[model samples]
Target: MKLPNTAHTSRPWRIHEIAHDFLLEDVWALPTPGGPDDFPRLVRQMTSGSNTNDSRAYTALFEIRWRLGKLFGWDRPDAGIVARVPSLRDRLPADLLAGPRGPVFSSVPFTSVYQTDDEWVAEMANRTVHALMHMSWVADEGGGYHGQMAVLVKPNGWFGRGYMAAIKPIRYLVVYPALLRMIGRTWELQAAG
Candidate 1:
C-alpha cells in the first residue's frame, strides 16, 4: 500500500517540508556523529527486540532516532527522514545482515537515505525530524496527554491499524502541533541561548 500523497495544494501538517529537512539532517548525522561503527551500534540498539526480518526494527529505530534528534535539535517529523534510515539499513555489510530467514531480509537496507540533506548542515534537520516522528508513540499516550494507556508491543497490522493505534495524539488534534511548536521553538532557544 502507498502512503498518502504529500504533493502540492493543502499539505498534511506541512509534513513535506519536515520530510525534506529530516533527510538533510540525516545525511550529515550519518557521517559526523554516527559513522560506520556508530551506525551499526544504532542498528543493534534499535533492532534488539526482533529477528531483523520483522519491520518492528524499522519502527523501533525510528523511535530512537526521534529521541536523539530532539535531544540534538532536529524535531520536524519529515517524510525524507522517515525514508532515509531504512535506506541505510538496506546497505548494511554482509556480516551485519541478519534475519529470521537470512536471504529474505537482505534486500532492505539503508532506507534512511530518504531524509533531507543540506550539504552545509549535514542533514541535521532531517535527523531531528526523523526522531520526532518516531517519538510520536510515546508523546501520544504517555500519561501526560492521555488519561488511558495502551500496552501494544507490536504495532503492525493488515490495514495500518497498529500504526494508527500507536500514533494517537500525533495524528489527532492535540499532541502533534504542540510537539512541532515546542521542538521548533527549542531550536530557536538553542540558537538564542
Candidate 2:
C-alpha cells in the first residue's frame, strides 16, 4: 500500500490509507477466504434491484470487492464482488447501538480497512444482513451512517434529489419506524433483564 504524504499530517481519505489505518494487521487474521469465492451472495440479493441473480451477484462482487482492495493497500478500490469472512458475524460494537439512531456510521477511512477487494464487499454483505434481520429491530439505521457512495447510483442534477424523494416515504415511514421498534425492544429486553 502506498502511504499518502498527507497521512503524515492528518488522516488521509484515500481508501488505501483508510485500510492501512483501520484494518492493518487485523484483516489478515480474519476468517474470510482470500478471493471472490468467499463473498456472501445473500447480501447482493438484499441490495440489488430486479437484475438477474448472476448480474446482481456480479455487481455486488465488483463494488464491494473494489472497496476491499483498499484495505490491503492496493491502489485502486478495484471491481467485482466477493465473499467475506464468517467471523464478520462475530459481533457489532455495543456502541454501534448507542447513537440516537441505530449506528449507521461511515467514513472514507472505514472503506479502506477491508484488506482486499472481497473484504469490503463482505463487510457490505454483513451490513445488508444486519439491515435485513434488524432493519425493524433497532433504533438508528446503523446510527444513520448507512454507508456512502452506495446511494449514488446515478447522481445527476435532479436524479439524486428525485431519488431521495421517491424513497422518502420508505425511509421515513417504514424504515425509521421499524428502527424505533427495534430499539424499543432492546431497551425492553434490557429492562426485563
- Each prediction's RMSD over C-alphas, in Å, is 17.7, 17.7
List model 2 lDDT by residue over 1-193, tens digit each. 1123332223222233222322221111111111233222212322332222223434454466457546643333222113332222233334322322212223211221122212232233221121112111111223321111111111223633464456556544454344334333433343346
For candidate 1, the 10 contiguous residues with the lowest summed lDDT are 23-32
lDDT of 1 by residue, 16-37 (tens): 3333323211100111122222
In order, the Cα lDDT scores of the candidates are 0.28, 0.28
Error of 1 at 187 (Å): 1.7
In model 2, the number of clashes is 30
